[model samples]
Target: MPVAIPLTTHDLNSGGFAAARARTTARMTATVMDLTREIPNIRAYALRTWHEATQRLAEDPEATTAIRAERDRF
Candidate 1:
């Protein structure tokens, strides 16, 4: 679907509508594609952070104990 643009009758008659539609479509497509590319990197960062924390807590008795104690405070 083409992106919606506010156009007057004069603008439509002057072919400005086509130009505006094209620009809007291109901008929207670029934005969606950029987000598609970035989402995996975002997910990877979250997973990496989770794994690092998990490993640290597993390997450090004091950190594990502190985390458990903190959780118990709730």
Candidate 2:
């Protein structure tokens, strides 16, 4: 006689897998947003540095003329 197999042991619930995937997607989205949040701050700092350098160059005419002469060489 052949042995009988139990079907209850093969129960596969897909709902658990879907829930786990949704949680993972949400966490990854949050992480990506957090990582890019500093972009604006970095841009602001660069812009401030550029403005200060421009002001300093404007205050010194000799440096500005030298920069212009060098710029025309390219």
Q: lDDT tens string, model 2, 1-74?
A: 99987645234335666678789999999998987998899888777766666666667757966456444432
Model 1: clashing residue pairs?
A: none
**lDDT tens digits, residue span 1-74, model 1:** 99999867886756767788899999999999999999999888777766666665667757866466444432
**Which 10-residue window of candidate 2 scores lowest in summed lDDT?**
6-15
The pairs that clash in candidate 2 are: none
User: What stretches of model 2 exceed 4 Å from their correct place?
Assistant: 1-32, 64-74
Local lDDT at 46 for model 2: 74
Q: Best by lDDT, which number?
A: 1
lDDT of 2: 0.69
